[model samples]
Target: MKRGAETRTERRDDAPRDHLLDRLFRSEAPRLARFIRKSVGNQDEVQDLVQETFVSFVAAARTGKLRTPEAYLRTIARNLLWGRARRPQHRDALHLPVDEDFEIAVAPEQEWMMEASDFLRRYEQALAELPARTREVFRLHRQEDLTYQQIAERLGLNVRAVKYHMRKALLYLDSRVNTDD
Candidate 1:
């Protein structure tokens, strides 16, 4: 009983320290995110860097090497920014905070939507290879965003058949996608 009481006391002491760390980290994240965003010009990419920075800081802290955590974090952020600036343009890099290039690349009038439509068209073709009932049910639920019961009522089929068709369609799609990859 005495040993258990001591263990509980130790845990109580550590809990507040953990809570403090959580609060500190949360406070630091938004500031870091905004700094990266203004410096690099991509909000989404800044979010990624903030996550990566926190992960690295946690790892380093775990190993007892964090003497000045804020300074360490700033050093990591600067290095990441510099490295991103130096990377080649054509590399298939993960998302990095980039300036006007990102805006131009992601504009709606550009090829992004066209490429997405092409992929969807291919998916529809693959879906059509299914039986008529399966394809119709899957399309109503997925593409047209109809509920299962709605599809059942509209098609005059039982709900169970609709569910079975959806299941088979999903399996077929999974197999086809894995093979294509």
Candidate 2:
């Protein structure tokens, strides 16, 4: 076989993997974006984080089989977030003014308060969107600090049902509260 034929054979061999990666990207990108948005205030940064997560996920996927791809993607995103947090900020020394008395004032507390209020508002909206039973389950578990078994007993549901509702509630809330929306 000629070199051209060999290249074509290699491309044909990779077609299935490429298709799988494309499907994975389509399905998981929005979910990952929402997850990252919870921690990242800036939409651009959230997008960048999600892109980085998928880039790492694709690299890993190409290397070996992933038993739980969703979980692996989340782990990659978390590591990227931590890495960004640990990176030190750099300022240009050449741009600094020669005057010794120059000072810069920043109101970090006010900025923090604004971000907190916005998050709370979004969280409340997400909670309100949940089904009544799911919302109650979440409130009982989170606000009242009840165990799953206790919540099950209180709501006359099986423990599994309570757990299911909690999971549904969390996923819905996470998707709804994303700043990208």
Candidate 3:
């Protein structure tokens, strides 16, 4: 076969995948952007994170079929956010201005502490919203550091029931705390 013909054939084979990717990007990018924006205050960083999420999604899609692409995109975006959170801040350099007299900068640690406190407040509020039994199960497992079996025994419930309460508590918390408005 001619080289030119092979190139055309390869393009034809790739067309469907390309179309699928384009469609996915169109549908998912806004949702992903909103998700990232909730966590990141910077618009530039939000755009960068959204682009990175799509890049990772495309690379994974090329390797194998994604069973749930939307969820996978969310997982990828969440991991990126976590990774960004773990990195040290360079804001001191970035925010330095020409006029030293008018400088206005907050320390990174202070900002982190504020965020942590806010997260804790939201978490407590969400936990408060849970049913009494579910809240008890969560507190026993998380705050008191009890195993499911231990919690079950302590509460006079079966292991399966304890697991169910924990699951319910977790889903409720996730929806309340992690959801993007």
Candidate 4:
């Protein structure tokens, strides 16, 4: 039967589905939190949005319209991220001084270079924590600017595996670095 057309009797008759929700709450919460952390740029905001996303998911399920729960949760988080980005406080904080009068005239050259070096070092450390194959593919594509086919050829991995590794590595680093930033 179509989901919404199910009789009220059938809705109450599902015990296994209730157990499934219990398990989902335990298993999916942390994973969703991490995903939200990666997609949004702040830790506190991640926590808030995680709660909001799950609450929305539960509400949708109760209303009998959540066909793909995980995807729906992620879509909620993506929307939250965009909303946060559009807020006035965030906008003001992120504003760049683009006027000519804002140009730097007398900064020491090595200052910016040292900051860049430190940032790259931290970034490399995070990259190094990934699986060896994932790291290798990432560096080849990002640092060496190699195409996925080139990366696959050099590493002897199938192109699909390379793509999977890239996605995993990016998600891992996203949760780790973006949260702290």
Measured against the true structure, the TM-scores of the candidates, in listed sequence, are 0.40, 0.51, 0.56, 0.41
User: Tens digits of per-residue lDDT for model 2 on 57-143?
Assistant: 888788778767877888788667655543433111124455768875535533544455566568888999899999999988875
Model 1's lDDT to the true fold? 0.70
What is the Cα-based lDDT of residue 12 in candidate 2? 100
CA lDDT of each prediction against the hidden true structure: 0.70, 0.79, 0.81, 0.70
lDDT (tens digit, per residue) of candidate 3 on 135-171: 9999887654568998999999999999999999999
lDDT of 4 by residue, 25-88 (tens): 7877788888866645568877888888777777767866455566666766665655654455
Look at candidate 3 and give me any clashing residue pairs. Answer: none
Off by over 4 Å in 4: 1-18, 94-181
Q: After aligning candidate 1 to the native by TM-score, how far in Å is the CA of 43 from where it should be? A: 0.8
| Per-model C-alpha RMSD | 16.8, 11.2, 9.8, 11.7
- lDDT for 31 in candidate 4 is 83
Between 2 and 4, whose TM-score is larger? 2
In model 4, state the lDDT of residue 122. Answer: 61
Per-residue alpha-carbon lDDT of candidate 1 for residues 1-181, written as tens digits (9 for 90 to 100): 9999999999998797688669868878877877777655457878888888877777666676454566567666765665554444412233567786565354432243344344445565678788888988997886445678889999998899999999999998777644533
On the 0 to 100 scale, the lDDT of residue 46 in model 1 is 86
